[model samples]
Target chain A: MAGLLDGFLELLDVLLRNRVRTVMTALSVAWGIFVLVVLLGLGRGLENNVRWMYRDDAVNSIWVYRGRRTIPYQGHPVGERLRYTNRDHELVEARVDGLEKISSRFYPPIPDSVRWQGKIVAADFRAVHPDHRYLENTLVETGRFLDEADLLEKRKVAVIGVQIVGTLFGDHPPIGEWIDIGGAMFKVVGTFRDVGGVNEESQIYLPITTAQASFAGADRVDQVMFTIDDAHMADAVAIEDEVREMLSRAHGVSPADRRAVRIRNNVEEFVRVQSIFDMLAAFVWLVGAGTVAAGIVGVSNILLVSVKERTQEIGLRKALGATPGSIVRMILAEALLLTGTAGYAGLIAGLLVVEGLRRWVPENDYIRDPDIELSTAVGALVLLVVAGCLGGLVPAWRAATLDPIVALREE
Target chain B: MIRLVGIDKTYRVGAHPLHVLKGLHLTVPPGELLAIMGSSGSGKSTLLNILGILDGYDGGEYWLGDALVKDLSERKAADYRNRFLGFVFQSFHLLPFKTALENVALPLYYQGVSRKERLRRAAEHLDQVGLSDWSGHLPGELSGGQKQRVAIARALVTRPRVMLADEPTGALDSVTTQEIMDLLKRVNAEGMTIVVVTHESDIAEQCARTVFLKDGRFEGER
Candidate 1:
């Protein structure tokens, strides 16, 4: 232990004496680690941004939209348009296994304006069953969402979004107050906030039955959305095929015509996005490791030059009773000191920069706070240490194998 | 304490091999102050290298004390050298980065001696060499003779059984050479086995015995 301390002190003095060269070599390593860490953080941020896009919607939900028929069935013309009705929603609910929650949405044909206490604001209005709240990850801020009784009674009740409340009601409490929508007066049952964003927040919702009866969309829905059990998410493509078949048979369209029935499976989209991010993460690691390897190579080159320059000194040490093993140990210690110090500096700097950006960057729909995992940071550190060892190996071996006689003769 | 019989050494330069030492025989008894004198290309340095265990011979039987020193592994050779030999080079090869005291203590460091004990011994050796006050100075800051004294101090701190000085005074002025020779004589008086390799007759005359090498073989002894 005492000998090791003495050797370390000697190494420190040696490094201190060649401060400029040591610093330059260390800076190259630092730059490499810094670039690697920063690039990884950026990659993580991009992945987070993609994930944030789905935060407001059910990841397991699938959306079926009405499309023009591309294949003729039951004597119907191929070009006929298909629209989903309440019966189709019932058919899907009864036929599809692993169904979690199902809801059909109808949007009014014309843009509607909402009025409360003489204040008015243009809003995008949609009519939906109560399960739409859960399917869209909508949070009810005040009062309750539309219930099954409201849908069955065809009650004239509405759920207004926070943005609409801000626009029409200002600071006024909106619950139990009457709001006029497209010449129909409905009592505001609840206020909601959509995780999607401000664009989604400016909309209003009503019970599907009431909207179809009151407006011109009687018994008709433009979109049907349903979530399945998460256990079935991996087999979502197969489940989507089943749903498509059922829809085709019920609507008198050919099952083979993909374009005739449009379905958007959020489970499949999430899986695709997740795989893409995984690839991106792996790519980031590869590039980062390559940069670190380059730095390690630079360290190795510097140490080789150092070994060459110190040939006579090494010879003198050997003459003074230094073993070949001791010489190798000394060289390896120097390499570790250089790389470890520089790598940690870069790590701290990278983390600080990431934190700074996270604190100052504005929140948007795509990106939230950008940062890397703790395990990744530690992994980089371990890689740097290993690289440092590798960087020292060849030079240390050369120094160890030096012939003391020839080395002394060098000067 | 040292014996070499029928030693042979060859050097490879490109393709052709040049024989440097051929069937050389020499011995040094304990506590002897001996010198080997030769001109350039006379294989005196090669013989010194073999004696110092820095190079291996092609064919030889070398006995240092009770151990046969031929074809030993590098680790064992280093151990033998550390335990039995101390070397002083022509240029006074004190490490430039270390203080005189640290350089003197380095041999003990290789022996795994604690810092306090090695430093104390190094200081004692420096005092013996009349360089105690200069111990803190770096080799660059010291005069040539002072550097040589520091090197000698380093060589002595390990308390090896043999001291090998290769051209120890070659780079010194006449006055400094005389001073160093006097120091070596003082060390010899204290019962140290000292071998000085040099070409100058005056340096050789300072030793109790001088051997002349002509062509990788000893020609005569004075």
Candidate 2:
């Protein structure tokens, strides 16, 4: 214990004697850690942006599309265009296990313009079941969405997007007002906003029953969208296969026909995106670690020069009965002090910057709340200590192996 | 108590080997003050290094208090040096960053002495060397004689069996050299075995016994 204290004192004395050089070496390490942490935080920020993009819709939802048949089945020729009816939706809902909420949507063949008074604005028009609002992440800004009475009674009630309301209604209230669509007047029941920005918000939603009865001319749906239970989300691919088989049988299409049906599972896509972010995180760590390694090499080189400069002092200590181990300990302790102190300073500074960004930076599409993981901070500190040890090893070995007689003779 | 039989040391300068010490034999009994004198390149420093265990001999049998000091590990050699030998150099060799008391306490530190006890004993040694008031002063603040005196106190603080002084007063004036030699004489009177290596005949005359070296071999003893 006494020897340890003496070694610490010796290290302190040596560092105090070379304060400028010591601080410079320490700053190099500090800058390395700082760059690493900031890069990692930026990486995390980008990942968070991707996650936020999926916030508007259920990550576990799946969208199934009707395509032309690729396989002939039971007198049906290959390349026959497939169409989905209400029966297919009912069949899949009855047969597919772990099915959460399901909705079918139909869109007009051409862009439709909504007319209120003398103003007319071109907008997207989609007719969907009442469950579509929940599946599509439509947050009602005013009034309420279409209910069972609207779908069941075939009521002529329309829910308008906020952009649509802004474009046609001006300063007047949109709800309870009549909007003309294709010469048919429908009452505007609600105004909704989509998380997907203005593009998604410039649309109008009406009941599928009303659209099919009034314009589509038959029971036809362009797409079927549904979500799976949280517990079954991991098996999203299998659930999609089951859904495709059930729909194929109902629509008289071959199950083996790849083009007959298309399943876009958001759960699977979310998982894939998560893996991509994981790889990105790993890459950031590699770059950060490389920077830290370079800093460690810088420290090692400086320590080697210091050992060369202190040849006589080392010789005097050796002659005064300091063992090789003591000499090595002294050098290592000095290195650890330099790296640990400087690295922590960098860590705190980086964290403060991250916190500052989180608190003050305005929200943008590409980044939000940039910060590093707790484990990453701890790992960086550990790296600093290990790097310090590695940085000291070569110089300490050189000092320990120095022959006292030859060293004393050095001028 | 020290002994050396057929000690040999050689230095390889470039491709040629310079034989620094050749089959040298010497002994210093307890409480004896011995001086080794020689001109430059006569191997006096090399012989002194061998006696102080600061350098290894190419071939020799060295005994310090019945322990054979041959081919010892660096750790064991350091232990032996700390336990049995103290050294003073011509340049004082005090670490410039340390206060005089701290420098004097260094050898005791390697001996695992507590800081309080080491400082206390170091203070006593500084008082003995008449540098008690300069204990807190750094080496840069001290005069040549005072620095040499602090170096001498450092050498004595560990209470080693043998004190080796290599040109202990070579950098001092004649008066300071005489004062250092008088201090060495007083230390020797306290039953401490002392060996002073110098090229000065006057310094050699102050010791109880004097040995002269020429071309790496002892010429005669007076």
Candidate 1 per-residue lDDT over residues A136-177, each given as its tens digit: 999999999999999999999999889988878878899999
Question: What's the DockQ for every one of the candidates?
Answer: 0.53, 0.48
**lDDT by residue for model 1 over B95-205, one digit each (tens)?**
887899999988887788888998999999999999989888988999999999998988888888899999999999999999999999999999999999999999999
The TM-scores, one per candidate, come to 0.82, 0.75
Best by TM-score: 1
What's the TM-score, to 2 decimals, of chain B in model 1? 0.97
lDDT of 1 at A333: 86
Candidate 2 lDDT by residue in tens digits, A1-411 = 266666677678778878887888788878888887888888889888888878888888999887887888978888787788887778777877788888988885644788989889988888998888878899999999988899899899999999888889889998899988877889999999999889889989998888888885489888989888878877888988888878777778876786788888898998788778889878987998888788777777877887887888889999999899888878778888888888888888888888888889899987877889968876876776687678768878888879888888788
Off by over 4 Å in 2: A1-17, A59-83, A90-222, A226-283, B10-18
Model 1 residue A377 CA deviation (Å) reads 3.1
Q: DockQ for candidate 1, please give it.
A: 0.53
Structure candidate 1, residue pairs in collision: none
Model 2 agreement with the true structure over B1-222: per-residue lDDT tens digits = 889899899988999999999998888899999999999999987788778887788988888878888888999999989888989999888988889999999999888888889999999999999999999999999999999999989999989999999999889999999999999999999999999999999999989999999999999999
Place model 1 in a CAPRI quality band. Answer: medium
